[model samples]
Target: MSEAISYIWLGVLAVFEAPALFSLAGIGIPAPLVMLLCGLLTGIAVGATPGLAGPMAMAVSLPILISVFGVSADALLPVFAFLIGIMKGATVGGAVPAILFNTPGTPDAFMTTLDGHPMTLRGTPERALKIAHFSSVSGDTVSDIVLFVCAPFLAVMVESVLDLPEKTALIILSLSFIAAVMGASVAKGLISVSLGMVSAYVATGQGFHPRLTMGVEALSDGFPLIAAVLGVLILGEVFKSIFDMWRGIRRKRAEDHNADLAPDGLRPGDIRRILPHIGRSSLIGCMVGALPGVGSTLAATLGHSLGKRRHETRKGPTDKSFGEGIPEGIAATEAANSAVSGANLIPVLSLGIPGNAAAVFLILAADSIGGFNPGPSVFNFAAPEINPELVVAFGIFTLMALGNLLNWTIGGIFMRSMGVMARVPNRILLPVVLLVTLTAIYVQETSLAALWVAIGFGVLGFFFRVLEISVLPFVIAFILAGSLENTARQAFSASGGDPFFLFRSPVACGMLAAAVILVVLLARKK
Candidate 1:
């Protein structure tokens, strides 16, 4: 236990002892902390605006951040902290648009719009925004604590027994779980997952020769990872927004030029009334987020539905229920969604599987940066010497806590004042985002082929969105394809080319069977 505490202490000091971004009054300030603040503010602004989101900002900033930071081991903490801050801040800022202008910033925030806009209409916009910020930050803090406690313990336990075959089965299980629980139709989610696996396998896998490449020199090297990801996530979003606007599916983002209502605040009674909803929603969100591809949208929906049910039961159907501008409604939705930010990291940090888009970027950061490898091995406490990856893991935890601190202190004020950002026309924002994204890709790859790959994937993403298919399964599957293939191949080799190698281990066989059962059950239910 002392050893563990010693490592944790080192991790905490590592962040404070890092190279300073600047010196103030002869005291050096850490770069990671500064970047966290900067990213948090930027994320809040982005979330306040319509047609922008945390993942979009993350996709655009990643390549540019890499270029500036140079992918050094020391750069990892600062770079990842900023992304973490953006994710945390966006959860709070997303409520701004949903409350003040009746515009949900992201799909999950649609739950917020139910009671949020009603609050604004009833002349309690300030109170609505404050409720969102407080609940978001509180839920985020709870989830972060869960992450800090759970990830290392789970990683260590998994490391003790998992072999190549077991790991292979686990990856298959994760993909299956993601496909089964992700979208409206289990079939559509499976299709998305299949497409991603196919895309990821092109021109890359185990073996001396690249099997999928069509003899083109550029294809031989395969698609640029960053470009493909950004194209699908960022460029695809841009193209879809433009297409929607052109097709009249989306109206121009005209501000509701209504009178500024009097400011309101959350009284003690209000806090007392909303606390239970926030607590329950936070628990619900954490549970959902621990499973890969079960996104915050579902969490928000479940939180709101259950909160409403409980509220109705208590009020005897006569009191002001949910969707009637009650603070509990805002508390339920915001807390549930925001809690997903930290709990989503559980898979990324412990299992090396990304549960969401934010986790995807974090895994990408670890891969691109090198040095720090995430997985069960990362938490190896019996190492004869210090484990650097373990230190980095705890440093990430520290940064996350700092982000929550910022959210608690100044987030409400900033979010309340961000009502004007909702009016910044998407017409002006979309083109700038497009150009910057393209530039960031080129600067990273320094190749025209990368640009073309991004455009191609972006088109594919546009269609996927149009078809109402979930992108989470696709993105998660694409990222995991290589890991699955490598583990399977190694297992096969170890079994002396036995095709039934994965079944040799009872645990692995049971896991694989469970995966199949999950698919069948979900498909039938859907």
Candidate 2:
């Protein structure tokens, strides 16, 4: 224990001296700190904008960051610090618009609008935003602590017990769970996952022929990950908002702009009353966040519903319900979603699997920069030489801590400022967001083909939303498809193409069985 503490202190000291070691753009300050601040500010602004999200910000910043940092091991620390900051900051900032204008910046924030906007309507927007900030920070802090403690143990356990077939089965099981929980109907979710698999298979095969591309030269290299994700989540949402704004403008239904900022007069008694609810929701979010593909939206929804149940039961079923300007509603929703931001890293760090859309971008960034890969290997305790990736992961945790501090110290002011900003007309704001997203994709890919692909996916995504089909399954499937194919092929080659080899492992068989059962149950319920 003493040796471990010394090593951690050494790592911290080394990080403090990293600028000297790496020559960080001739700046005296450490690059990680600089990037963390930049990402935090950028995330808050982006999240305050109704049509943008954390992954969108990540997709846009990643290429630019790699260009600036020059893609070395030294670059990884700063880059990841920035990504971590954005992840934390966006969760906090997303609540601002949700409270003030009923315009959630991301899908996870959609639940916040239910009670948060009511608070705004009741002239308590400041109090609502304050509740969001405090609860979000509390939840995020706890989730990060859980991730720090649990990731290593879980990774070691998986590394010891799971073989290739077991890993593949686990992925399949994760996909099944995601499909079961994400959409209104399990069939639609499965269909979306199938489409994503098809998309992933297109032009990405290692076979003699480029499969599923139909000889299209532009698709020979397959879809760009950043562009595809940005298109689906960011541009798709932007296009829908644009259409909505146009309709609203046609109907002369412009939002009533409010620029006055109210003070949040939260009492100590109020904070004490909400602490139990925050702790409960944070734990719920942390558990869900650790699972692959079960995202902040579900966490927030569950938290809100559970908190409502508790509130009603306590009130003897006669008092006003949660949606009518209550701090408990904001606490529940914000706590869960913010908690998701930290615990989502558990799957990414321990299993090399993205739990949500934002983790997908982080994995992509790591892959593009090419120093580290996430997996159980990352947590391996190889004694001779240290695992640098683990150190970097710890460093990211530190940066996340800094982000939370920023939230606690200055977040209320920032939230109030965004309340004013949220009143900006969407017609004007969304166009700029759309332009930036397209420009980001163009910058990263440097091909008009990528832009066309993004546009196509944007259209597809908009339709998916309109049809109430969940996009989470599709996105998760697309991101995991490459890893799945590679792992399965490796396992097959080892088994000399014996398809029955997967059944040889009890773990693998059990996971497959679980997947089948989950699918059957979900389908029956649907």
Off by over 4 Å in 2: 1-14, 20-27, 246-264, 316-320
TM-scores, one per candidate = 0.96, 0.91
Q: Write the per-residue lDDT of candidate 1 for residues 1-66, one digit (tens) a residue.
A: 887898888888988998999999999999899888888988898889988888878877777778
**Per-residue lDDT over 1-526 for candidate 2, one digit per residue giving the tens place of the 0 to 100 score:** 5444544554565456566323557757877877877787777877787767788788778888899887888888788878877887788889988887787767778788877887777667777788888998899998988987888778889989999999988888888888887878889889888888888888887787888888988888888877777777777778877777767633221244343255555756769867878999999999989987778888998999999999988865565578766788889888998898889889888988788887888888898898789888776665467767766666666677777878788766776677666777777877887788888889888988899999998988888887888887888888888888888999889888898878889999999999999999989988
Candidate 2: global Cα-lDDT?
Answer: 0.81
Q: Candidate 2's error at 251, in angstroms? A: 13
Best by the lDDT measure: 1
> For model 2, which pairs clash?
none
Clashing pairs in 1: none
> What lDDT score belongs to each candidate, Candidate 1 first?
0.87, 0.81
